[model samples]
Target: MTAPDLTRRLVAELVGTALLVTVVVGSGIAAQRLSPDDVGLQLLQNSTATVLGLTVLILLFGPVSGAHFNPVVSAADWLLGRRTRSGLSGAEVASYAAAQLVGGVLGAVLANVMFEVEVTRLATTERTGLPLWLGEVVATAGLVALIFALARTGRGALAAPAVGAYIGAAYWFTSSTSFANPAVTVGRVFSDSFAGIAPGSVAGFVLAQVVGGLVGVALVRYLHPEVGEAAGDVVVPHPETRSPS
Candidate 1:
């Protein structure tokens, strides 16, 4: 099969990230409106929507771009595949990250507009602190580990549902509500809704995610020393990284 060109892959990343954020922020808004007084119920509703939406998005875009939609995942892919030359090049990783970031911001704006909220307003919800940062580390570590593990184990076909399920569960288990993606964290800064995180908190969350990504990479190396052999399949076997037949 022919690999997708860089432009097409980038577009897929952009569109996929945008839609993921839309589902996240849009559902949060809807959940707030539907269950105004019950924070627990609102979170449940939001998480459910996000899980289903994310799974669908991955299935939809995985063929074209691997449906990473997260900078951490892309970076991890590059790092793991560096020695084997099976993963993305550094330039491709950069492009993917950039596209995901732009898409994330656009998705947040779209969500705010749909919910009739202020689109340009920075989030006022403060989500900083030691516990939240720790939660982010744990959440991101587990996410990266799971993704690469599946790829290495020849279970890439299950990534969509597996990733979606892990994230949905992380929402309940993690203290920080698992804002594990840097791109999404930045995107959420554009809204003041229930899902938004204040701009002030973005740096801390991003740093934690990066640290978590490193930890995840370390774990995959320790547990699956040969993971590099399947690095091209991380998240899913998209055209960009699919092995040439």
Candidate 2:
């Protein structure tokens, strides 16, 4: 795609990520209020909503932006396709990251306003330590692997339900509750809700996620060595672009 196409894609990423963060933070807040006495119930409610919301978002916006919604995914795409003619450009990667980050913060603020909470309140949910960081690594690695694997195997159409389900499962299986998206991680910092992560821990989580993405890239290379061509979109299936690669 050309620069103009990239701009449109960036806009889609921004809007999709904004709505994603809203759903995550909003659902977490609602869960906290509804299940005040039950942590498990709160988690169940939050995860269910996230799964459904994410599925819808991907389906709705994948055609426009590939529905990356995650900085790591964009980074992975750029890194893997750096040598390819049709790969994402450095400028596109930068745009995607910036949009996702800003959208995440905006989404959190919107959620706060919708729920009558203080806007831009820093999160105090202390998520730290080796085990949780390890969980982040595992969660992020799996997510990256899943997306690339689907594309590599010509099953991109399954990204919506498959990724959503994987994330929902990761919420329970991973100790960190699967805050797999870096943009989402950063966004969560603006809300001291159930989905929020403390600002102090953001650096560690982001680092772990970066490492996880590298691990995922290695896995995709080892498992799908033949994935050289532009297998449709980077993260999810989108309407085929007729523009020159």
Candidate 3:
């Protein structure tokens, strides 16, 4: 795996991010429309649904590409020696990031349509700020670290379910409830539907995710120095492999 045929991975990110956000926001919209007072239950229900959807999606498509729906995951995979096989060259990363960004925006727009909202933010909706920002950093770091540990399980088929479970659990452990990916976060902005956040705050949220991603890689190195050399190294795929880890 020299460069990973990044276009494929980018397309994966695009489609995956689109689906992730659409479901999340779309559910939120449904909850609001159906029961405004039950916002909390609706969010929890939607969050749970998204986790299952993500798990299934990862299991299904993680192989066609790395399933790196987020740049953070890509960066962490590079650091962990797993994002791509050989095609993970610089071009791959950049293209994937671009596609994710575009996908995110497009997903947001689509959510707006389904929810019959314009510009995404409901105004009544507010994001948890600075403290939550730091929380994002911590939350995403834990997620990447968990990814690394499970990735080494040598069971690609289990990766998606494992990742999904981690996310579901993470919702309870962390303060911000783990937005984790800039791409997903940005897409949510267009909905103002269920889990929508203010577009104005997207920059800070992205910054936090970036920071968390790096921290996760660094933590992996610090905690498991023996495997550090393998970080981001590509491998040939097998039916057994989720994404060539």
Per-candidate clash tally: 0, 0, 18
Question: How accurate locally is residue 195 in candidate 1, as Cα lDDT from 0 to 100?
Answer: 98
lDDT of 1: 0.93
Better of 1 and 3 by TM-score: 1
After superposition on all C-alphas, the RMSD of every candidate to the true structure, in Å, is 1.6, 2.0, 4.1
Q: Any idea what lDDT model 2 has?
A: 0.86
TM-score ranking from best candidate downward: 1, 2, 3
| Each model's lDDT | 0.93, 0.86, 0.68
Segments of candidate 1 deviating more than 4 angstroms: 240-245
- Expressed as tens digits, the lDDT of each residue in 187-243 for candidate 3 is 776665567777677788889989988887777667765443333321212222224
Give the CA lDDT, 0 to 100, for residue 73 in model 1.
Answer: 96
TM-score of each: 0.97, 0.94, 0.83
lDDT of 1 by residue, 1-245 (tens): 77888899999999999999999999999999999999999999999999999999999999888889999999999999888888888899999999999999999999998989997689899999999999999999999999999999999999999999999999999999998999999999998999999988999999999999999999988999999878888688765463333
Looking at model 3, how many pairs of residues clash? Answer: 18
